[model samples]
Target: MQPALFAELRRLYAAADVAGDAVQLPLLDATATARALLIEFPQASDWPSVGATLSYLADELALPRPALSVSAGGAFTLWLAFASPRPLPQLAAFFDGLRVACLSDLPADRLRCHPLSGLATVPVVPAFDAVVERWSAFIDPGMGSMFISEPGLEFPPNSERQAEMLAALRAIDDRQFARVMAQLPTPPQAAMDALPLAGHFTDPAAFLLAVMNDAAVPIGERINAASALLVAGRR
Candidate 1:
């Protein structure tokens, strides 16, 4: 599973499109290749998409920052490792949820989520694309967009830099993953109450829907309701 985390980055390069729409997803129960998770965006048209997506994860989801890799092609990738192997089906859904939620503008067809197996194309490994004769490796995000036009490098990235990038990469623990998984998108339903969210509901949105729409639930109570939604949101 460990080796497959790197392999998944290569897989993202080949299988770059996985989502169908913004609201409802037909997530593939893609089995795992490793103990890691790599959420890639093949539909990222500009460098800002990369920045926005990263910011959403950091600021909104409060997830551990993932390593970013520029592919042999023009697509960008986000790689996250786990302290333990995660079930591929749940992992797939979790990742697809993030893609749909954070990258809301991405069309249904152009998105890619899961990482499958590919030989020797792992990020930071400096694989040579024979067709284009350029290299692929982990890059500093501050300077990542500059490489987006032509992701492959003419020469090998400095080994020490690559080493530093790899070293800086952090893995998600079970508790951290579980907390975020509580917020990932679920299959659409008629009402938020239908979801098995906190205890009875599958959705925290239902709590908001109930409190926000009810006139009897006063303004001060409404403010408290919004604050309470955080606890309701957790699994």
Candidate 2:
């Protein structure tokens, strides 16, 4: 095993910061306060979108850069480390704002942030994907486009290199987090709250329209539906 691989992963993404001796993979719970946040871009062919999103965060939002990783299952993840544990609710809101801001063309269905779900399992890395016969690794962003078509490493990455990339990443600290959250368009809709749109309605507007008209959907949900519809329509 590349020992430094896990060492770097643990340093940045671990749910609980351990001192000097802990060796287990992060034991994460859906509702637990988080020390790291992962925003995964799932479409294998959309490296341009990933690049654009990065530009939006840096050139526009003026936020610190996150370490990038290619996942075992074919996605590019922007992994943000928090210097201290922070609540998930506001982070979820911030992610939603990013989606609505930059990725309106990309369906939210294909994007992911976690461990925001209880049923989900956060695995140990260099996690193997048996189906694809590939492994996950942190990547240099300059070379990220190469992975779009064949995401994930066929073999393990260099341990020292992995450690360097992870080390170079700057964790978002308290002041930065506050400023970023404040920049969020007041009350960005938590897209997780909107995930229940029934499967039959492939069209998002149709789903929201149905939600808006259905008295059974809570009044707040209906309002959110209308708000989403308005936001979506304007774009």
Candidate 3:
């Protein structure tokens, strides 16, 4: 992990009004490189149900239950330190499933699972870390508060929509993928409307490209936009 990102994470933990002692777990081969997962709740009142859910998931996944950290903020971070390198695709799939199952209904809050390997030179680890770092800041409460407060704004797509978006991206049909991207409730009208250059572009390819390249927008939204464009770009 970059020193800056590590410092930011430490700051987040330290700022928590209430927090539990960190629990270190071995995620890969027995080594000094163990990963940590931190679970933070907005208040002590929210801990029981969230704790129970985490416990249930730990039991189901055969992973250790994460210690709870109560705080005034609503975000939770699951930091995984891998002893050995793992394939990015495999890890992404596992974390995606876990996030959907565990965090689908959580309100105005975010759950992020990041995998870090001690060996930074390992293939894909640096790139994956960059992606996580970018998206982590992109989803911060400061950046997302406006969208979260917007009426009818689907800040995070539901399970059904998530599946649909993923399928559209994987599908070979560019037109179908574009249609799905166009209909998504995220990257709200305000975002799209702000893009005057994209106003004349009705095709999904141009619209998605516009969104992806817009630095004013959140990285998560841009990533989704990029995914749609990638699917469309496939010939």
Candidate 4:
């Protein structure tokens, strides 16, 4: 994280005035502090610690639960993402263990988790449910459909998976896919209007190309595409 950015977040959290129960104060303070740090920190491995801290604080404050994710890369460059359902104090303890596993000095090994060579499945817990629910909320329902579900969890996909999904869409029978796409509900006009590219694609090919070729498009547009694919795939 950039020093200036971190400092600014610290200031923002510090400046917030309390207007609730005194018991809420410490938890609120901790949540703000952890959130600020998490937002500022780019390293995915560090997320557990920050998430755990914030979760602990949130619990203490009796605040409505929020979701969290800890994603990392593997030996062959495969990505891994995990989430928790509701914030739990145990996650903080788990974060402590993750911290030890991720040594401070090593960059590549830091926070890295991967699938074992012999293992065909990745491990997951109930917490990931909350993560998926919250993540889905952030995305359009169309995009949210792209999320893949395991026995216990759902997650936003990585770039490679996104590419593969796009490829699959290309391979699908066009008329059938179009019919399916038609059934998908249109997203909010506000979200669609916010982007110049969305709500304007008359053809699936154009939509796919816009998603693949347009690096300059806003992040929200990309998110929309992902969500749209999720919804489109369902059909």
Better model by TM-score: candidate 1 vs candidate 2: 2
Runs with alpha carbons beyond 4 Å of true place in candidate 4? 1-201
- Residues 24-115, candidate 3: write the lDDT tens digits: 22233332121232333333334334654555454554443332221212332323332223433334333344444554465423333332
True-structure Cα RMSD, model 4: 23.1
Scored by lDDT, the top model is 2
Shift of residue 64 alpha carbon in model 4, Å: 22
Q: Per-residue alpha-carbon lDDT of model 1 for 39-133, expressed as tens digits?
A: 56564365677788788788887877777777667677676666555554456456556655766675534444443211212333446677878
- Best model number under TM-score: 2
Per-model TM-score versus the true fold: 0.61, 0.72, 0.32, 0.19
Per-candidate total of colliding backbone pairs: 10, 0, 1, 10
For candidate 4, write residues 128-154 as lDDT tens digits.
234335221111113222222212124
Worst 10 residues of 3 by lDDT: 119-128
Candidate 4 overall Cα lDDT vs. reference?
0.30
Residue 5 lDDT (model 3): 30
